[model samples]
Target: MGSNYHINNVNGPAIFGDNGRMEINNGTDAATLLRLADQLVERMRVESPALVPQAQVIQGELAQDGRPADRGRIRAALETIGIGVAAGSGGLALAQEIGRVLGL
Candidate 1:
């Protein structure tokens, strides 16, 4: 029941089991996932311009001060951009790396 984030080779972002398989879960902590989504957006802007717009949309939703009603939109956007977020401990190292890179 662990989760991990992954940037798929195609069809955009996705979430899967931590055991290196593609198994979807319910969801993860929005705050933390949104932060990672933000980082992914920035990275995509530099690495993959085509995904920037979608990523921006997700970022904007996450940035909203309310209850983040656009979680589904955010997930869809990430999926469209070949990114995924999972819930579990396996991604801690990658998350740390992202934080360091993004200076979060």
Candidate 2:
């Protein structure tokens, strides 16, 4: 198996399997994903407050359940997060990985 990489892309989490292919949910059923992520954000408040607004932007991009997600907006949101965090943050790394997959 390859390394596990987590991305909250609008399409949902994507995993790279042993075959070097990305396996993702067909579309998105993540209606409440951002809501759940917000719960985690609460814990992060004392540590990384700057991420709160970035998280909000990401939450805004989440798709309604049973709908096709906006992959482009999701990517853009990642870029926005990249701007708000340190270079070494997971958000930047995730965005880079996603860009590689997207041929950007």
Candidate 3:
């Protein structure tokens, strides 16, 4: 059987597979999250160009292939731009998905 883990401030819970592997639901896998991060960066480039650099750093980290990255920095950067990831929101879901992918 698999187990579910609910993280505070995140939109959805994550599942631990029978093989002890973690997976997020609804296609929120690593690649998808990375794509989402890229989209976010692009949107920021237009709407908030000043924050694009921070988003780029996140994109770089995501491109590092499961290497350890700074979740705090990512969160801080988003927060600095008033982007809070509330429950059930796409932002929260994406962040949670990224966290799972990065093994945070």
Candidate 4:
């Protein structure tokens, strides 16, 4: 089943086959996809505004002292999400985990 598919409590005759499979083609579900994308964007928008300045400051300080936190992991993760790939259930889980961590 595709990530966006919603199965409800509707008992109906079989449509596809005895065992069915669902595919999300070309991400045509614009409204739902946009909603999910917006959620991700919002998270970044909130987290990023503060982080970018801090990152730059820390990076500069570390360069001056010859010690830097390797931020490649964070940069790669951001790039991965920027290229239209849905983060899937893992993203949702991470978001929930963040909420729990912050006591939201």
- C-alpha lDDT values of all predictions: 0.53, 0.52, 0.61, 0.37
lDDT of 4 by residue, 1-104 (tens): 65554365333443232136322232233344334434544554455443334333322332433543233443434344333233454444433332222222
Error of 3 at 4 (Å): 14
Off by over 4 Å in 3: 1-27, 83-104
Pick by TM-score: which candidate is best? 3
Q: What's the TM for model 4?
A: 0.25
Q: What is the TM-score of each candidate against the true structure?
A: 0.45, 0.40, 0.53, 0.25
Q: Show pairs that collide, candidate 4.
A: none
Model 4, position 25: C-alpha lDDT score:
35
Stretches of candidate 2 above 4 Å error? Answer: 1-48, 90-104
- Clashes in predicted model 3: 0
As for TM-score, the candidate ahead, 1 or 3, is 3
Q: What CA RMSD would candidate 3 show?
A: 8.2
Error of 3 at 65 (Å): 2.3
Clash count, one per candidate: 8, 0, 0, 0
Tell me, what's the RMSD of every candidate? 13.0, 9.7, 8.2, 15.9
Using lDDT as the measure, which candidate wins? 3
Q: Write one digit per residue (lDDT tens) for candidate 1, span 1-104.
A: 99656544323334332345454333445577577767767666666677678767766876778563464575466455554334332233333433333222
